[model samples]
Target: MSSIIKLCSSLSSRYNPRLIVSRFTVQPRLCSSVKPSSGPSSSSDHDLKASHKVDNFERKILVWTGKYKSVDEVPKMVSQDTMERARNRMRIKIANYMMAATVVGCLIMVYSGKKAAERGESVSKQNLDWHKSYQAKADKTEKDYASKFEHMAREGAEAAKAN
Candidate 1:
């Protein structure tokens, strides 16, 4: 029963996510003092040896795989070739868009011109009718004024003769 309990406990620990994560995580040591197993001199010497070993281990583990110390030390993610390709693609896209816009503008202008042409004939006919009416009224007014002037001149001539 004791062996079974131990096996179960070990299996639980192995399957536990938190225990697995904590086992792999490196915890920082606050101090490098080794607990004295013997005399003070021996303990001091042991502490120094242990600290040196820890430093070497840390230095080995902290080595950069890419020879980069930080993000700033890393090379640019985008290559010049890729940037140039993207620039060319963007230029092509802009050219296509400009061509499409020009076509649409031309189509709009053509449609408006057709509509204007359809309306122009009716507008010109209405203008001709208006001008004819105006001219007829002007001619009648001028004849009326001329007859009034002729009657006044005849009256003045008769008055001069009588005098």
Candidate 2:
């Protein structure tokens, strides 16, 4: 009978341990050290001092780089070969684009001139005479620009060699 009564008491306590734990464990209170300040002046002053130190450190690093940090930090100028390759690529791209544009413009002009001629519209005392005139002018302009560019390139090469 005594063993049976002990078994019953143990079963009852196992099912309700929360009351036992709460009665024995102590709850913790908040600490005073981490509480927020009641005023703004101290906080602002602290922030300003932090920012000033950061600025001073940045200036020191800049001065340490060289007399003028910007001038010293700049990478050396590109090599002439690299520049020449870039220039050549750019010129080729420009030439290709200009050629494409010129072809497109000529096609458009020819198509329009043909349409006007079909409609019996007289331009410059002859039907679609303006087209021929503009074609001649365009041919001359292209030749002139080509010769000028070639001359400039030759002169530039000579000047570079002399230098």
Candidate 3:
């Protein structure tokens, strides 16, 4: 604890915020030397990349998965098992999301329906009322169009008689 406190004090004394260069100021590097990479993550990534080459036995799995029509179409140097595993993981994830969404939608529907019931809103009654109103509107429009058609027919007949 004492060493930690001493280290903190030393760091605090070394880096004074006011003495430091402002964010607006740009300072050129004192040393232009660049160090070589130790190659930790890169080496592991390369190994994983190289591991993707599929064995001849695993090629059939890829073909069975419908990703390729036949073994001949399957790539000789790719990891089919890894691709299949990734695809399966993705499918499971999507299925879980869809299930969750369905549950949420059902819950929302139930809550909204309950609220509407409280407000005396009936879907069947609303539908019947809508149809009734629509029919009334249709009847009114038909009557209007019928009168217009009758007037047009009379005018047409008079014109024919004049001709």
Candidate 4:
């Protein structure tokens, strides 16, 4: 029993999770004895070098979370040329959208005009058929009235000749 307990304790100590994790984790180091840089140029140069070292992956991991030791280590979020190109792309996309919309609107207008013309032609044909029927009725009524007047005139002339 004693030997077994000793073996367990040794194994636990050797495989301590905290110690294993700490060995792999990189801890931030504090510089207490180092003096500040003497000149502004030297400090600025150090900052420039640090900033240049911050690539996409470093910037993503270190800068946003404030994990960097100094503010100078953070790089610019985006370059000027990249920003300009993005703006130009946006403008071009908007122009393309507007052009497509204009073309669709013109197509719809043309289709509507064609439909309206077709409807107008049908309506005109119906109106012409109705006018022709009305004109035939009017001509028949006129002929009936003229024949009645001529019969009355013949009767009067025959009566005058007999008297």
Candidate 5:
């Protein structure tokens, strides 16, 4: 740890921030004379309108994402690449939330199933018991119905003989 600290201290002493700032001096910039290089053109006008629309849309996205308070707070010029990056970040955030929800759901299911198992309650066992009881009840009902039909036929034959 001391060696690392000594190395950092030595590097900081050798680094001169003022020299770096002086080497990279800011220069004044000049733009167009606020006049069109060519006469008014329909294509240029359409391009400007389209670009403005794209910027406005990106600005709205930035504001909606909480990066800015309002559209006015966003910059006038924003690149398509930057907008795409913001969209990706939003998508990732949503995906993370979905994943977390799925994880929580799975945990709940697992915990409940474990507790049920501890109480000797199994889905397969319940299904098996239900099927056994249903089959037995169906068999008994069928036998009772068959016996009643036999007795009825016998009574009908006796009545015909007496007639």
Candidate 6:
């Protein structure tokens, strides 16, 4: 039992199942010794950093739980075998959900881009049609102006000759 407890404690430290504090000591103050500047907690920044880290971890756990809607914390109040099985089941379920969601999201993005490309191709075709119509009208106008110029020149020459 003692060995089991020690093992559990060791594993907890390694996995950080929860926060732990270390012991501290104070020096014996003499008349010449200046008064201590601050308490151990106040003097050490480790506590602040540890708390921040713990908070971040807790937030991540909360988010994961919210998204999955089901998960169990370690040291579960059940048989060890049952807890292990549950954890394994949860891991598999979460993995499947994440993979399915990712695949669906990727598919949606790909199809959306394909739709946009199709729309762009249709718009380009319309623009090409407009260009072709405008070009045909311009060609007809140019031909009409050329024929009028030639007719005017021929009539002018004939009038001069008669004069």
**Tens-digit lDDT string for candidate 5 (77-131):** 5555656777787788789999999999999999999999999999999999999
TM-score computed on alpha carbons, candidate 4: 0.29
| TM-score rank order | 3, 5, 2, 4, 1, 6
List the lowest-lDDT window of 10 residues for candidate 3.
Answer: 26-35
lDDT of 4 by residue, 24-132 (tens): 7944432223566767566565554443333565444443344455546655644444344445666676689999999999999889879988777566787999999
Error of 1 at 120 (Å): 0.6
Candidate 3 C-alpha error for residue 145, in Å: 1.8
What lDDT tens digits, residue by residue, belong to model 2 across residues 1-163? 6775564466456744222223779444321225768765765654443332223433333334332265344223333443344446666766899999999999999999999889977566574577789999999999999999999999999999999
- Candidate 6: which stretches are off by over 4 Å? 1-76, 121-163
Q: Where's the lowest-lDDT run of ten residues in candidate 2?
A: 49-58
Q: Which candidate is the best by TM-score?
A: 3
- Each model's lDDT: 0.59, 0.59, 0.72, 0.63, 0.72, 0.60
Query: What TM-score against the true fold does each predicted structure earn?
Result: 0.29, 0.31, 0.48, 0.29, 0.46, 0.28
How high is the lDDT of residue 56 in model 1? Answer: 34
Which has the higher TM-score value, candidate number 2 or candidate number 5? 5
> What would the per-residue lDDT of candidate 3 be over residues 60-123, giving only the tens digit for each residue?
6666556678888866565445676746866776789999999999999999999999999999
Off by over 4 Å in 4: 1-76, 121-163
CA error at residue 14 for candidate 6, angstroms: 40
Candidate 4 has its poorest 10 consecutive residues by lDDT at 26-35
